[model samples]
Target: MFLALKEVGQSKIRYTLISLIMIAILFLVFFITGLANGLSFADSSSLQNLKTDYIVTNEEADGAVINSTLSEDQLKTIEEQLNQQSTPFSLTISAVEDKQGKEVNVAYFSVDTEKYSDIEIIEGKNISELTGNEVIINENIKNHGYELNDIIVDKISDTPMKIAGFSKNQTYTFLPVIYADFDLGMSNIYGDEPSYNAVLYTGEKVDISGFDTLTKNEAVKSIPGYTETQGSLMMMVVFLFIISAFVSTVFFFIITIQKLNQFGILKAVGADTKYIAKSIFIQVILLTTIGLSLSGLAIYGITQLLPGEMPFKISPTLMLGTAGLFLVLNLLGSLLSVYKVAKIDALEAIGRVE
Candidate 1:
């Protein structure tokens, strides 16, 4: 270990370049991990945080909330039979105008507002005040210059709007969320008769009998690209790492061959093959550690720069997995050099001089 660091310190420039390769590979691994998490969150934010066990939507819709609609009356029917509180899934509705004259696509959820416990008010009145004209938005939009009492204009029926308050960071289908009264929620999207996209079952699984009810995990898969996108990205992440391990192995093998005479001298002087192997392996671990640590910081900075819709999430478990993968890969790379070391001829270094 001491000699390895000593070698690194002496020719730091050359070693820096070698270490850079490790850094670049680790950076890519972490970056893809971030993308995987981000895309999943972006794809499932609608139902991920809901305090419900399952969602009830029209079976024909095949789990798509944005395209499905159920009448509020249907919601009432489901509620009456409930063992616990259920929420009407008021999703869909696009191209809303803020009274301030800006236009954006939005997802509006119509809850009884007074019923759910997770829908916290971070900056405005409780959802009970969300009426036909009053609306609640997320901090993400509010940070975009929209403030309390400001009107958001909507081209759909030229809906009149007022920011009654702001809520914590709750999002749906990757869009910044806007919560409103059930009547306003429907009027904003349907323009008339109000309805919900689905119903959320919170207690002892409201018996839908003939209707379909999906657990929270099952519901997110209905979001377009939710499963396939994550599956594809995850595949790419694995493929990239396999390539990296091979590349590192090849590079280390070449470096080992060039140092054969030196290794032979050490071996001839009583150093065992185990010592050489251990030294080579330690170098691999050190190189990968440096790369991955640097990339972790870089990925975090990049995540902060992205919008809420960008599904790049940071999970502690994932970081640990990434670190573990890097270490294993580098160990595999170092092991490849052992074959070359085993072939070194101790006699060659004795009197052979260039």
Candidate 2:
């Protein structure tokens, strides 16, 4: 450790340049990771916010809520069979016209108010208190110029509803969510048919014939484009890791080659191969720590500057996990330089082999 510090102190410029490269690489990795998480949350915040452990969808729908349909009778049977408290809700992706006649895309969540009054109202009255054609909307809809008591008309049904409240993080499939009463919404949207897309249960899994039970994770995966988007972003993160490893290996290997004569002299003076290898490992760890710390600060600043609508989120767990993984990869990469140092012949390195 002492030798490594001394070397870095003597070659501050070179070490600083290497650290800068690492910082840039780590910052990009962290930024992309945050975006991946943010997009996921924005796409399914409504479902993610639910405390339920599992969801029931029609077997024919193959676990996808959008494709599933359950009548009031089927929901009662499932409730009796499972003997658990459940929430029934229906979803539809459609557009509603604001008071100004401007169309705004929305994900309508028609829920049974008595059974599921979990939609938190950040402003105005709760959905349960709403009577007549009143709906609660996601706070994000405020970006589109809607406010409490504003009137929005359903383009399809020509039914006008008043915005009763605003809720936070209530989005579905990247669209702002609007919560409505089940009886009123189903009658208007589905022509007097009392049906729901799925049922949310708050207990262990139980198999019910003709219906498919999906865990939270399974249901999340079933969201359209969710798997594909996450896979692509994750692939980019993996590639960045590979690039960081390659950069670390080459940088340290070159440095080791440049200092062979000095290493030979040290070995002759009783400095062992283990000491030299430890120096390389210590250098890698030090540089990685500095890079990761700076990258974290940089990401925090960037998130602050980003707009609220931008899908960018940061979690401490992700940051720490990424930093730990980066440190490990860099250590593994430095092994090549360590191996080269171990193979050095003290006599030949000092030009005394002849």
Candidate 3:
């Protein structure tokens, strides 16, 4: 360990460059993972906030909440069969005009607020207090200059909906959501027969004949583009991690080769191969630790500077797990060099071979 530190101090520039490279690679991995998580959350925060065990959708809809259409009879049948309370809801994305007449895409959610009790109100009254023309919006809309008591016009019917309150972290498919009461007026707007997109229920198992039951996670995946987006970002993260390992292996291999003669001299003077290997291990550990720490800090600083609209979330647990994987891969990559050091012939490395 002492010798490894001495060498790193003597070769400050070279090690600094290597450390910088490691930092950059790890930063990209961390940032990409964070973005992937953020996108997933943004895509499904509305559903997640429901805190229900199962979402009942029409089987024909193929697990898509938006595409599912459940009639009053179907909802009642399921409720009767499962013997649990079910909240019928509808979700749609449409352009709505802000007070300034600027159109913005927002997800409109129609539900019986009294029955659906999982919503978290961050700054205003519960959804039950909202009238047909009154709505509760996600706080993210505040970024667009909308506030409590602001009037937003539904583009479809030109109905002015008042923002009665704000909810925290309720977004669907990356768009801010507005929760409105499923009154007779809103039901007429959707359809005359009173159909809902899906039903939210909490139960162990649902045996509805015509409807499909999905867990919360499954419902999230049913959102369009959610699965594909996450898959692509995760693939990139995996490839980057592989590349980092490869780079570390090559760099350490070259460093080990250059130090062959030094290892030979130490061995000739009474140092064992284990001692030499320990030094290499120490150097790899120090380098990886310093690089990952800096990368984490850099990610934190960058996220702080980003605009609120950008979907980027950093999970401490996920970051720590990623860092641990990176450290293990780096150490494994350096082992090739350690193997080389273990096989070093003192005489041959010192040019005493005849």
Best by TM-score: 3
Clash number by candidate, in order: 12, 0, 0
Q: After superposition, how far is residue 260 of candidate 1 from its true place, in Å?
A: 2.1
lDDT per residue for candidate 2 within 1-354, as digits (tens), equals 999999999999999999999999999999999999999999888887765788899998876788888887998888888897788878887788765678888888887677775666799878668788788889988877888998888777777888889998888887888888876664347566765888887777899998999987788788888899999999998999999889988998999999999999999889999999999999999999999999999999999899989999879999999999999999999999989988988888998957
Q: What is the C-alpha lDDT of each candidate?
A: 0.73, 0.86, 0.86
What's the best-to-worst order under TM-score?
Answer: 3, 2, 1
Off by over 4 Å in 3: 187-190
- Candidate 3 on 107-196: residue-level lDDT in tens? 888888788774788887787676567888899988778888888887776678888899988999888998888772444464456658
The TM-scores of all predictions, comma-separated, are 0.85, 0.92, 0.96
Better of 1 and 2 by lDDT: 2
Cα lDDT for residue 229, candidate 3: 90
Candidate 3, residue 134: the lDDT equals 82
* Residues 224-273 of candidate 1: C-alpha lDDT, one tens digit per residue: 77778888998999998998888888878887877788888988989888
Q: Could you tell which candidate, 1 or 2, scores higher by TM-score?
A: 2
